[model samples]
Target: MAKRDWNRRTCAKRGHTTYAPSEPELRERLHVATAAGEAWRCLRCGDFALGAPHGGGPAAEAPPVLRGKALRDLFVLRLLAVERGLRGVLGVLAAWAVWKFSNSQDALHQLFDQDLTVFKPVADHFHWDLEHASVVDTIRKTFDYKHSTLVYVAGGVLAYSLIEAVEGVGLWLGRRWAEYLAVVATAAFLPLEGYELHEHASAVKIATTVVNVLAVLWILLSKRLFGLRGGVEAFEAERHSASLLEVEQAARAVPAADQAAV
Candidate 1:
């Protein structure tokens, strides 16, 4: 009776021959052999392990490659995240402006109503016109600085900012509900965006409208939202089929008898 070697026992249990060299040594050998256009032959099975350098049992499979629509969908999700993030930032700025204007109503009114005798002399020196009644009137009307109006605007902007932030986070995390929310929100703004374009056409306005429209369409069609294009079942099936683990298992499947024998 002799003390059983654990390493040999483990190898026996796995039904594979164990190499004496360490992993690093095996890797180096495999690397050199592969560069020379020769395969690293396995000791137990007498088969070329090709690129496998680590003990030559089974070659490590590469991660599942996302191609075609899967890759496009991921890119779209990131794009949506960026768009939502920008909207969130704009909402925050708007909210801040509302708060500042609301708090400075008295100061704003005083500055606008004060006499401009000294400022007129300075303006004349600089060849500036301080007597533009239309400009002054517009400024006064725009920044009436009503506390109630400011409060209401700030509340609206704050709520919108929260929604944008939530959509950004959810889209970034690739949540399904986030996709639906993004689609709905973006679609809701399309009509307003279109009307703005009709009122005042500009490159920025056109680009924004196009991007939002495309985003809405992509989410609806690609994600199979609202019972379109085979719905949720098909969408989930596509995701499962594209999974790395699933791909690897399918590619490396062996017969039951072969697995038992191994």
Candidate 2:
């Protein structure tokens, strides 16, 4: 009887429940335990891992190297660039949604509510006569006053918010993936931005185009995305050394040696 009771207790301790634990429950338990447990902390990121991916893996024993100011600056720039890129994308989406639900409003009317040949070059280049296009007619025909294009607008806002939020978080966490994503997303919209500038050539359009180009350049050149190893770090080290020397000199400077010694 004693041995049988002990076996049952042992089985219970070993997770021998009548029903299997759901994934979420198991995950929650693991998370709780990990949070309470002591583990190795990453020097660079301050993240803790339990013995790395594989037992005694290469990553488990490696020490985090010090990052230089250049690398840190690159990280910071990446964060800002991705955030701005997200905003740019959201701006496009918002514009698209507004156009979609405006009951086939003329692009010229939508652009600035002034009747001008600003879009003429675009129409000629694309052979798209917004004035008499069948697609425009169909859109107008299908339009209703009660129609709320708010759905598209809401979707665009939500998508933009979420994407930007993710990129922001990834950037804050120093993820390399976010930098690439920012670059790709920004590059994808260059053509559209160029077109917009060409269509209107307005101050706003020009500023938008310039900002996007600068952002791309910042991510590519300043951030040192996909550069050879140690290059960014070396730059950072030089910057840090210069700063340290400045600080040291400031510390050594005396205020007229208190005048008595002089």
Scored by lDDT, the top model is: 1
TM-scores for every candidate against the unseen true structure: 0.64, 0.39
lDDT of 2 by residue, 49-123 (tens): 444221221221322232334345545665575656577577667756665756554453455323325765787
Q: In candidate 1, what residue range of length 10 has the lowest lDDT sum?
A: 16-25
lDDT values of the candidates?
0.69, 0.52
Clashes, model 1: 0
Looking at model 1, residue 177 earns an lDDT score of 95
Q: What is the Cα-based lDDT of residue 137 in candidate 1?
A: 69
Cα deviation of 100 in candidate 1 (Å)?
1.7
Off by over 4 Å in 1: 1-68, 112-136, 248-262
lDDT tens readout by residue for model 1, 1-262: 9854433343345543322233343333333355646455333332344553334333333233343456557667988898899889999999998788889877876886675655788878988877775777677775765788888989989998989989998998788899999998888878889999999899999988898888888889999999899999999889767643344345445554488898
